[model samples]
Target: MDVSVFEVIGPIMIGPSSSHTAGAAKLARIAKDIVNASFNRVTFGLHGSFAMTYKGHGTDRALVAGVLGLYEDDEAIADSFELAKQQGLEYEFYEINLENVHENTVKITFLLEDGSNYYVIGSSIGGGQIIITNMNGFQTEFTAQYSTIMMKHYDRYGIVSEVSAILANSHINIATMRLNRNARGEEAFCIIDTDDIVPYDVKECIEQLDGVIQVQVINVND
Candidate 1:
């Protein structure tokens, strides 16, 4: 197996624990980007090790900062609470026990301004790396370090190929793709990682495709 340089040397980030700080920030930021909307309030459900040392280790501040779109290495991570308060982004945290999950897992729930809400569940797997395990209620695993597009659509033949064609037409190469469905012929979700940044127009075009329900283009690299 070939290990990348980031895993070998760790990431450029603030705070002490890579799991609690960098990973937490990335997880939250990705969740925010996934929704691609603004939320007036957020809630963090800390599980396992995160619950034990979050406040002492600055996980609280880091998580909040990420929701506000601050970088992992941003010094503003230290002042996230104050900045959030000033920006009218209310937040809260609580501890909860979950089964068969990584010790650094967190559930971030965002309550959007229009009374809509969504949640993202992920784990900080150390060395500043993270895996978003679930979105809304779909079981999935994706890293937020790349350009990705996730869409919800009807479970039908040709949907995956349809999305692939669109990406290709936009001059984007697919790195990886994962698909999950609630049941056969039911609603499905697809995550596509790309070699290039996904344009917002590309996302709009995907949304117009037949059988596609919703589309979210996340380009955390930018």
Candidate 2:
């Protein structure tokens, strides 16, 4: 099996435990980027080890700091709650049962000021590594290792071929690609992990394609 640079290099963080601290922070940071808006409220559904040892291990603070767009090494993480209060960000924690997940799993829900909600379920699978298992109710996978593009489109013919052709034309190499949908003729989600940086022009090109409803890119450094 292959692995990402992140998996080998590990997350840059101030931590005694990577799975509990660094992984939690990365999950929140990724979630914030995906939402792309200031949060109005947030809920962290802690499961298993996260629920039991989060406070002691600083997972709670790390998660909140990530939501505030803080990186793992940011010392301000210790004051994340007060900072959140000052910024008028409301937050709460809940212990829940998430069937068939790792012990360091967490389900995060973001309520944006625009009245939109996004759900992300991820797990810290040890060694400062994490994988996003679900997003916005879609059973998909995301490991913020390479530049990634996730798009929602109408389940129709020619869309996949058109997108691929455009990437090929731009010299963008797709490292991996996956498509998931409920049924035929419905909304579909596509995740494309690329080997090279995906420029704004590439995203603009994809967005202009027919049947493309929404497009999101997670840069490698993000």
Estimate, for each residue in 5-123, the C-alpha lDDT of model 2 and write its tens digit: 76777768878678899888888888888777677899999999999999999999999988999987888888999999999999999999999989999999999878888889999
Model 1 segments more than 4 A misplaced = none
User: Tens digit of lDDT per residue, candidate 1, span 42-67?
Assistant: 99999999999998889999999999
Where in model 2 is the C-alpha error above 4 Å? 1-10
Q: Which ten residues in a row are the worst by lDDT in model 1?
A: 29-38
Model 1 has an lDDT value of 0.90
State the RMSD for candidate 1. Answer: 1.4
CA lDDT of each candidate? 0.90, 0.89
